[model samples]
Target chain A: MTLDLDTARRLIAGTRSAAHERGLKPLTVVVLDAGGHVVAAEREDGSSAKRFEIAHGKAYGAVSMGLGSRALMDRAEQQPYFIAAVTSAVGGSLVPVPGGVLVRDGDGTLLGAVGVTGDTSDNDEAAAVAGIGAAGLTAQPAA
Target chain B: MTLDLDTARRLIAGTRSAAHERGLKPLTVVVLDAGGHVVAAEREDGSSAKRFEIAHGKAYGAVSMGLGSRALMDRAEQQPYFIAAVTSAVGGSLVPVPGGVLVRDGDGTLLGAVGVTGDTSDNDEAAAVAGIGAAGLTAQPAA
Candidate 1:
């Protein structure tokens, strides 16, 4: 099923609340539908200008690749040139980062992805996981 | 004064409904906030693959220039070389087409922009205007 607007907004709210509770920096969160299109996005006050783009890139990359961005990051580490080529192929929209997490339903069906930016990669990932959990969804991050 | 998520979704739905009523082709619509960031976007089934990007480019260009895409199209016609240079400088994100319309609040404050792509440029413009009106907002196209 498609990730509806209400779910996407809830995901963003959850991510923002988790970021606040953890004392992370202002964050930008983006949710992309299964078709790799933006469903909803929000940039918290004090977030940098590029945070939205970065967050969107991460979510788009995850949905396009059908894997969490952490997996892409791991692959990029081993094959930087390949990842660069992929980036060029996609017109520079791919972001191999840790903050992108895949969203799945209870039956393991892919819904979409959530990407966060503005803090350390690990912290961003944590917030994403917490947000997905708070929304009662599954976050499938790369091992 | 912001384009909240609910407003953005309403604009998209209104655009889709207008397109359907007019018997236009499948369309992709995008709404950008005042900061030129995507608030919501959707590509209808059977729409072309690049419709989302084109719609987003049109909306972003409108918000960035604080005018409608029709105005940008006029400017491009008068100064093709300068417009080309600007397009190149922005990595080709600006679409000087007729489908982008500026959205304004009742108080005449700029809220954001909506872009629609699928049918002819004129039809797209009509759909964008109809969508904004249905959402109880003003669409400020060039005079």
Candidate 2:
């Protein structure tokens, strides 16, 4: 089933909760449905102005490429030109970063994606994983 | 002064409350700082996928023109070519229509803007005005 607004808000809250527990920097979180449309989003106070776009791009990339952004990062490293072209194809809304995670259901059905920005990329990934876990879903960060 | 995240959330809540009280359709709301950066944004469950972009464009257009989108609409009708060129100049992020209201402080300082979409444009503008009022800010929908 497609992600719903209630679940999207929960995902956003869980992401922020994880960041708060870790004492990480204020973050921006974005939840996108399987079709890469935003379901919900929030930016904590003090986050940089561009964090929303960065967070949205990460999640959009995950859904558009059908892979976690960590894998996208690997591909980018191996084939920069290819990634660049794909990024252009997506209207420059792809970020090859680790903070973007794919969400899946028990039946291995892709539900949506969550993207986080604020802390280091790895830390952001950790937060995203925690959020997905908190939402009772699986987070795929690579492969 | 710039609009903070807390106030932005309040405005969003207020906008939704107004829509609910009036039994309006599901809506998308966007808050943008004076610099035209997103502070916060949300789309209700049933809103169309592109509501966020439309809402954002309404607010961005208001702040960019230093007037409410109602005025922008008037200018667009009076000078279609100019509005069209300006829309292209802003990367096509300007929506000349109602439902985009400028936010101002007591001292008449421009703080930010709010955009709403889903219902009729007039109803959307009403909700936006209600939201700004709830946040204790003034809403300028014309001039």
Candidate 3:
């Protein structure tokens, strides 16, 4: 099923709850549709102004590359030039990091992605996973 | 005072209400801080994939130029080369148009700007105005 606005909002709520529980720094969360388009995005009050773009880039990259951003990070280390070129190719929305998690259905269908920022990359990924789980979906963050 | 996330979300809600009341097409709304950075953004379910970029550009142009985008539209018409140059200088986030309205405080202090897209330019501006008013803020659209 498509990622609707209600589900996207629920994801953001869950992400925020996770961050709050762990006392993470202020965060920005972005939810993207399968087409890599923003469905909803929210930035915490004290978050740096650039957080939205960074978070959006993370989600967009995950959805566009068809791989979790963590895998993209591994690929980036092996082929930095290729990742850099793809970043340019996507108009600078590809941020290879752990925070971008791919959303998937039970049968392995891609739904969309959720991106989180303003914490450590691992924390961000954990928060994204919590969010997707809260929405009753699976998160396919690559190893 | 900085524009908080709650206020920004309220603004978006009001914007959507206005668009819905007017029977406008699916819309995207973007809220930017005084620094011309996104605080929040949302794309309607059926909005085009490009709507977020366009809305953000409109708001960024308004906040960056210190004038509503309607005035920027006029300036663009009178000095296309200058506007074009500025657009490139801002990393292509300047969209000179009517849908961008400046947010202001009672004493005329600049707050931020909101951009709406998906309807006619005039209609979009109207929705922005309605949203700002709904949030108990003033809307400054350059004459």
Indicate which candidate wins on DockQ. Answer: 3
lDDT (Cα, tens digit) per residue for candidate 3, span A1-143: 26878888888999999899999999999999898888889999888878988898888899988999999999999999999899888876688989999998788788899999998999999999988998889998774
lDDT of 1 by residue, A25-140 (tens): 98888887787776666666567756778998888788888889999999999999977888888765878989989999999999999999999988998999999999999998
lDDT of 2 by residue, A52-136 (tens): 8999989999999999999999999999998889988887589998999999988889999999999999999999999999999
Candidate 3, residue B11: how far the Cα is off, in Å: 0.8
Which residue runs of candidate 1 sit more than 4 Å off their true CA positions?
A1-48, A63-66, A74-90, A103-113, A118-139
Model 1 per-residue lDDT at A98: 90
Off by over 4 Å in 3: none
Of 1 and 3, which scores higher on DockQ?
3
Instruction: Give one digit per residue, the lDDT tens place, for model 2 in B1-143.
Output: 28888888899999999999999999999999898888878889889988989999999999998999999999999999988999988875899899999999999999999999999999999999998999899999877
Worst 10 residues of 3 chain B by lDDT: B1-10
For model 1, residues B5-67, the per-residue Cα lDDT tens digits are 678878988988899999999888888888777666666656765677799888878888888
Clashing pairs in 3: none
For model 1, what is the alpha-carbon lDDT of residue A143?
43
Give a tens-digit lDDT track for model 3, residues B13-128: 99999899989988899998889878888888888888988999889899899999999999989999999899888876788889999998788888899999998989999999
Task: Specify the poorest-scoring 10-residue window by lDDT in model 1 chain A.
Answer: A37-46
Candidates sorted on TM-score, descending: 2, 3, 1
